[model samples]
Target chain A: MPERPGQAMQKSANKRRATVADVARQAGVSVATVSRVLNAKAGDRNPVAEETCQRVRQAMQTLGYRPSQVGRTLRTQVAHVVALLIPDATNAFYAAIAHATETALRERGYAMILCNTSEDPAIQDEYLREMQAHNVAAIVLLGAVETAELRTAANSDTPIVFLNRRAPQGVPGPFIGIDNAAAGEAVGEHFAERGWARIGCIRGPQTSPASRERFEGFQSALAAAGKPLDPDLVEQGALTIESGDAAMARLLAGGHRPDAVFCGNDLMAYGAHRRLADQGLSVADVALFGFDDNPLNAWLATWLSTVHVPHSQFGRAAAEVIVELANHRGERMERQILLPFHLEVRASA
Target chain B: MPERPGQAMQKSANKRRATVADVARQAGVSVATVSRVLNAKAGDRNPVAEETCQRVRQAMQTLGYRPSQVGRTLRTQVAHVVALLIPDATNAFYAAIAHATETALRERGYAMILCNTSEDPAIQDEYLREMQAHNVAAIVLLGAVETAELRTAANSDTPIVFLNRRAPQGVPGPFIGIDNAAAGEAVGEHFAERGWARIGCIRGPQTSPASRERFEGFQSALAAAGKPLDPDLVEQGALTIESGDAAMARLLAGGHRPDAVFCGNDLMAYGAHRRLADQGLSVADVALFGFDDNPLNAWLATWLSTVHVPHSQFGRAAAEVIVELANHRGERMERQILLPFHLEVRASA
Candidate 1:
């Protein structure tokens, strides 16, 4: 898509096009070194030695190796582009992470390309293949819908890092996220102190391992507090406002009148709050709790209580690990990197 | 960085490597046809005739061709990656547009790559160069900080589309955005209907043309209503809550007791609202207005009256224009496209 001169295709006497590896061999340097020189600028922090850069240029001229016509990306290790695959970017939680990750990647001398998968397995698989074909240096998965495809796609050629989401069992790449069970336990304890008798759960999709873990921790905490989460009170669906509203309706339609509700995420909590408000009920009548302290909570959802995941910390850690893996090829870092989470007490719960 | 078999690099007797173009020549078809065959799956909607695809495969097999050994991105017109450059994704306004654009692009057989510039000229310039190097099929710009650089970067090779922001003068690209001045007039008219006196303005940075245009429209409408916007009541800074709050403080500290204030964006209005609340005042005491009815506005900022720029419409329009440009290379389409805007009168103004 970038411009190349007409002379690049005009061959003299139809000679074979020289490759970047050929130039590397002639310059007596590694392919990576040549690639770094080609991609980096004069005052770049990478700082390829001027003398060696001159040698590479001289070697290129002698071999008539025009970088434009040589298919440079095919033979080079410096793609310099990282792909971040998330389920949805419209969510404030994911947007915060994406913003932080983009900032961190820019600081790490790499560009991030964000792809939204909308929690569709086919879409995620297609994006995985597309990233491979595009020669991205690395990938960061926030929440993937297809684990087996991701497992098969993980290789030394293109490293993958899971952020704020657990990777599949035995996935080779590093997984960087907060401990969901601990965070959920914290939320449950905070809600438990209120002494609510009937605590209902509006969880995310059943396929999400994080949701199940959080549900388990909440149940255990509630049981320890002598107010267990009722099995008939839990509803699972998409982690969206519409789903939360539907689930809240279902919970209220039944004979059991829950005094408090725990939502999978803050958006769902917002939905549940609005749903209650529509029925001439305030949050004080039925407390609401949630996870993922969205960035807009202070301005918008001031009354809802939720858990705050340090979004920037998780993004920075994920980017740092991916960069490390990219710089040191064929290397594995920590298998699981955990960050801290916070529970914020607000008016709703 | 995708995995390639070891045998791809272990050359057999040092023979010359074949190229995709070479295979196309051998198969008696265009290079694009061969690339389509190579990248498409068995059930793709881009129905390449099975007979032609078979001939291309036969040609490749006869020539000992391995796609992993070739730079498939180069020498082909099917990059299929449309890059959307926005100021920030954390802003719910931009995130809404991004979500809509991604859905449209996926439906059109393209993947959208989102890059956040944070309104930094240097970062935007660097991302422009990076996108070119990565061979993105097209680029869509929203609130670009550096216009001259973007004008120079636009070309037929990778078509550019200006989205929700006007293009630089003489730039060769389709500018698809709402009429900012008209939207400002609508806001001003709505505010005028309230019969407020001594209206103040918390404007965005002076460098933004849209902000200037909006101010002009607002001033004109205020004048038409016989209540002029005082120059002493205006303060300009970053379009963020901090700036808006500081601007409001400056307005009050300067002895300008304004009954209403206009913020350049919704988040700024939220700031102004909070600033008033801190002083034991309310929106009814000093009405506040804003633009960009963010997705979370209904849930979070229920009282802030604002202009609603249809984010999904803008996103869908931009994506459609870019896909058309990418499919029809070297063809100049419409120079400017305008979408509609609406003024949402909420409790704040």
Candidate 2:
């Protein structure tokens, strides 16, 4: 993913100030090497030869280049900035991850620029472009926009670590998350053990791999238990309370209401619970299960039984992965770290 | 306040590339004028004189200066970045505000950097320093650290707008929020109407102005109604569920279980509610009033009757105030904009 020398120089020359890219191009070295030479810690051995370091330093002087001083650490030449992109900040699940990640990053001497794309592809692309311009050390993505632009950006050399998601097909990056399919299977197993014949599920958008996997796993597990999911009971929501409410209502109106229902997330569960309550059906009458056990769900007067995915661990892992990637001085290795998830039994289901 | 010419030049010359400050000093003009000339929009009347614009352009050329392309808009010298500093992101009240503000800013072609200080003064100081380094256009603060650094920074030229908070005495800035005292009085009146004699209150930390105001108003209203708050019934918490739970426990152990209780915020109410439930004391047995009618309260089976401060409005107002200040090229103005608050009567009280 290293930039072509001609392309790097051409882009830099077009600007009045010579960027880090310009120094790399002029010194006939990679951007990483130039960064290391300029920002090397006192005890760290120089990866580049002394003469080569001098050459890079001289090129920087000749081009009037200055390292990004705003968030740049003089010792490591790494920007003190990290960008955290989430789909929705208002969602407690993502908010918890963000809060944990920000705390972890700050502890590591990095300032995070938290961006909420609100699940929009265009905004995601725009924020990625902005991050590129700022020369951030790394980016941690809690959600992704699966578009050509995202695919292109992911293919680039910018160090990225995704939380709760894998890089889309054709893109390359490390990821840390729970096994969505396995978690879904756990829900199915639980329902089958309770001998619930008519089961319903509300899924997220199909574009999300996590959502797709969850739906697939749940269906497969039910099929194995001789009770395949009824198409009429299956509904899709956009992961909002309103969507969940509407989806639940649709499921009920389809002639057979599920004795027990599984929601894609805790927010949807809350919505589904509300819809049931509105229809004079109590949670005790219809068992409810949810994924992503946000703290709010447990604290509610009526707690939800859900798949407890450790969001704090997901966030801390993301920070650690990015830090490792940023410090790596050679070819990048692809990693996929899976965290554990368990079903939390509560009163609702 | 414009930087002194000598100070600007000295600061810029220490780096390799000449900054915007360097160009302004060389052109004998204010940084705002230099910014305006370089990033002028189509059909917008040039703010600087033609001759002065020429001098600025020449200075840029001579010094090889480049504007920050990462998050900067060509139409305004302002960086496209705005930092929203919140005390806690996990708290639904703050999360709602953060979400609304981010949406508003994004619509105005600005990206938001959300920072969670976790209500720690040290972290607040660290974040403020980091924001200063990143050169954000404006900062909307949902919380503030009462420190000398914060006081000094407020007096600087960086446009700041306080949301749901007032600038500490010496730190002057514009603010947008509901009248906390009035909202507290409303909660008190509601309790008074119910004719609850033994009213216990759980207040947030004394350092929080919002918390202090709420306690004062609630106590005064009770006195006005010929019923005064018992000194033994009062407890202090950190506006958290644990704090609320412990405070409620203390009230019960004091051999005077109140017929009703008031919490400074919804989070504390949730805690107190949980504790009462644990003791087999249903909310129906004891009326509870909470400030900040967070959506969670309504979603819970036992709803909370509390003051509803329009969080979305508060967020939008913060964005508008900053946008106005950014667009104003002349002197800065300090204005206190008060929004309305109302009682959202629900089931718990």
Candidate 3:
């Protein structure tokens, strides 16, 4: 049988964890002295005696004493945790964003609790309530839907940053994201420049702000080229590869066979690519473009032309805003930050 | 300009959050009564009066009061949070495991704090220390290397579950993983049955137990069939797509041109496929096999024959073990749970 640390210390069946008090007792010093030695706050004029500090360190090492962050958080009334609410985990776009955000947050001494809501309103609300109830230091919502419960939670003391998504009007938080309309317009320009007459589009849900913006901008760009939108060529996807594939299949099977198609995101593009290939139709014949240049685009053999939304930049920018907001809680500051994006034209288009 | 919540709350320029005391005051009840009503513990014969309960609920709603979990945890000495440490987030294999683990943990009423170690030992150590300090409910380490600090942490009171990785001997924790050797042997049998000679292998670092086991089992199986292993045909990869590509390039550029190759994981296999395609060597000519049948296998056009480890099952089993150990902290329980695996034969083989 493995001997637990608690039991190892007890020398009996009864087990308990070592506390600061135990370390203090072992070091023959006050709990405050031990804490002072351990914390070693900067700018403190009076430092602990070297011998006393050494004794405390030795005592801690001997007792396997690890200071409890829970106790510290209780005293400070601020958790060193940040809750990241994302729509999906499998999507490479969100995953890359998460990776970047986690890296940035770790550098700033904050642990990230990732919540995959999967576009479920109930799950999003539940996670929001939990983050608020836990008093997490900050909350970052990436491509999340706005709800009354979320708006109410936004009124709490916990700092909030909207990453790749904007909260409802009147909500206070920094939203760091690319201008989707501009990116969409760039894609539209690419298609028009390529002289593709019959165009099709696969957009995300109507409720999604980013999707709506992209669709509107694409329409505006096409109208500028004297090509009004064709309702028959438009389809709504659930922002998934399967949905993209189905949408592409519908377009291919429909009367209006478009020579070009722009997907809402890269995953959808992959789906479109697969579906097109399955039907013996090639991406070269139907120029395919996607949004969010996820890492898969660079790795996969199918080079998808995409509007690159610098996910790492968004992560770094959101971290900066959230950390700034956390440091200046209750102080008015800029609550919106828009980043730049580029159109990466690859062989697929 | 967004009207900040702090300013909105402060009609008279002084703002504060509504607390339990405020709720109790509004409900005309004791704090303890409100606590009991809110908690609603099981088998509590003395339930709060229906009218009082309604009043308390209404008070809570009107005040927008959210109970702080920090206070509850301080009192209860346990957090409703678990930490999942992964070596890489972008790797589809680890991502699938993370997604599954997070879903299982969510079902069990535990929030998951994902730590992306990125295969950095320093980062891993820092996260381990942070998880221990935070006193998270439990810690789930996915494919972590054994270290003295980790061993010490394993001996702590927190329930730990090693998922897809085995701890060194005498480590106090439950390890949940598939029998890699058996899985590898299955792959070897497939190769031998196909009468494939000149078999090359790309294994992960020697430090990885899974890699070593797979390589060993493959060698053993090949030797059992009266076919001795060729040391020159084996190359150690970094378990990445790029590494696999480089390893494949080396094999093809070298004198020994193996007709068949087994990669450590799917990412590496993807890399090898890309390199082979670039070199005008089709997968059809050089049979390629991989491990970890992640979601990408189904999405990608190339069907890769690989060993399926049932990642979701591994996650569920790990959660079960961790939850059980947490509930029975000091009790002697099963410390190891070995899962079964099978070889998934796809077109690439």
Best by lDDT: 3
**lDDT values, one for every candidate:** 0.76, 0.78, 0.81
Candidate 2 local lDDT, B1-349, one digit each (tens): 1111321101111224355789999999988888789778778765677899899999999985655544243233346678888998888889889988987887776667778887688888777766755556788888786887687556555667788877888666777887788788888888898998789999988988888888999999998998999999999998888998999999889997999999988888888988999999967887778887786665653478788888888767877777777776233556777788888887888
Count clashing residue pairs per candidate: 1, 1, 0
Q: What is the TM-score of chain A alone in each candidate?
A: 0.79, 0.79, 0.85
| lDDT of model number 3 | 0.81
Runs of candidate 3 with Cα error greater than 4 angstroms are A1-66, A253-256, A331-334, B1-67, B253-256, B331-334
Estimated TM-score for each candidate:
0.77, 0.75, 0.87
What residue pairs clash in candidate 1, if any at all?
Answer: A300-B300
Fnat of each prediction, in sequence: 0.22, 0.24, 0.34
Interface RMSD of each: 13.0, 21.6, 7.3
lDDT of 2 at A44: 84
Per-residue lDDT of model 1, residues B136-240, tens digit only:
778888886655667657643556778876666566667777777778777777778878878899987777877877888888888888887889998885788
Query: Which candidate has the top score in TM-score?
Result: 3
Candidate 3 has an fnat equal to 0.34
- CA shift of B102, model 3, Å: 0.9
